[model samples]
Target: MKVLNKGLKFAPTKKIDKFGVFVDLQKFKRSLCLKKYFLKDPVTRQVLGENDGWRHTELKKKSHFYPKHLISKEITTFETMVLDEMEKIQPMRSQNLTKEEKEALKELAEDTTITIKPADKGGGIVILNREDYDEESLRILNDRDVYQRIPYNPTEEIKKKFDKYIQKGENNEFLNEKETDYLTVKYPKIPVFYHLPKVHKNLNKPPGRPIVSGIDSISSKVAEYLDHLLQPIVRKIPSYLKDTGDIIRSLNTITWEENFLLVTCDVRSLYTNIPHNRGCEAIKTMLLEDGEIKKEQIDYIVEGIALIL
Candidate 1:
């Protein structure tokens, strides 16, 4: 009983088309008729009126429909039966896959000449020659200005420094015992480096957009805490726009003058090019100007930012 979005269409794979068990149309139609009858019956209406179900608390919510208890129970029972039947058919469906399609899929998975990845900006998959993908990724990674070859992994070194910082903060009463414990990283790994090709920029020779994922790095907890502290202040900034939607809303309010000029700017590799010292100083300035953040908290935040940078 898979419900697809309106206007959305998809062709089933050969294996799926042959083996998939869809809902019985007659049963589905009968269920719909039952639901319609249930809604229109006078007895059901009287029950709803007596219970004041129209003004029920759940009605105000937008996420899910809250049907009348009797209707809901009946629907649940019907669905359960359908699901049970589906489970019985599942084993049979797996055994009935077309051998040709199955073999093709297996061969495709094992192929070494090509790589498949989601497009950097668009909402579709992109297939590229495996050699080309590797070459492009390495070319970007080898850029001396953006990345450098390290002699050894710095995971333990970074973890030690992070733990020492937390211990020092706790000793100085800047952070409570619980806060220090929360910030401590039991297991930290070095950030993983990857890149997604910007296919929209150039399909034949797409530039790789470098990504350094630090989710499991030593500074992850500290970074998360710092972001939590800074979010409120960030939202209050006059020029802060959360996303394209925010920019659109802001643009709608502007009373354009004849002399006013609309200008746009794009910084190439903005994140990698940012000077650590200048970035930290900017953050410090913002933290200092913010009246809500205490001086001690600001100092801790600045130190954390410096460590992360």
Candidate 2:
């Protein structure tokens, strides 16, 4: 099936529209009302019991139900509460901002000459000249070795190929009918490429950490399925550490020598540097060596990975 329209192109929003903010506010208010209902009785000012029929009934209705006593004043109270909370916290802070600071932030948001993006590593924002941002992004994208300049959109072509592959898989019994349907892309989107400035690395001319948003992309479901299949094999790797916490846990199990020196290394452009054929072969080798996956399943997994790559 055709997923995305031929003319569909991604355009990033520069500012939050009023309607979007209003919708968010309404959702927040509904959440607050639901929290109040579940945590405490709005009318009786007491905690609700687990088996409360009234609460369960209201929940089953799936409506934002409020007590009769709060029906009149609840909205006004929620608005006031939201305003007060917003006053106390900025987007990245729990502390209150001064009037001048708030005004400055409002001005910053409205400014079109600059772009604000979060740092790649730090929990901080980087404000860059829009021209510089575009120039840097272009520099990265123009690298002939990494990125190829496409003359035209290939979304439809890719979608057709993917659909054909899935159909073939179902016909050959590599995938069941249900699996074929589940893997089919309903609303595929071209992945949006953006980058976060690595401020910690260099403040003056921060290098950008490339990011490709894969939400609703043609291979998103296949990627997710492959990830699920590979996760067990990944976890079994000896050097695998899930996160910083995992590293710490692993470190604690070691008996440290006084003379030992710890060394750490970072791979430069790891993802972009890896040749697609080699990467796929590496995965295929790992799965084969593991002996847990069948040959047909391994082929399926590799094919999915190739589609994603």
In terms of lDDT, which candidate is strongest? Answer: 2
What is residue 225's positional error in candidate 1, in angstroms? 0.7
- How does model 2 fare in lDDT? 0.72
Tens-digit per-residue lDDT, 26-122, candidate 1: 3464556567765677343333113421111111112233233434556667767866776555322354457886786688689899776666776
Q: Provide the lDDT at 207 for model 2.
A: 79
1-309: candidate 2 lDDT, tens digit per residue: 001222433334344354666678777766666676667744454432233211101111134454434333767677677666656654343245566766877898899998888778746667888887888899889889888999999989989878887786666565554456677887799899999888777888887888889887888766765676788799998988999999999999989999989999999989888999999999999988988767776787798788878
Error of 1 at 168 (Å): 2.5
C-alpha lDDT of all candidate models, in order = 0.68, 0.72
RMSD (Å) of each candidate, 1 decimal? 12.5, 12.8
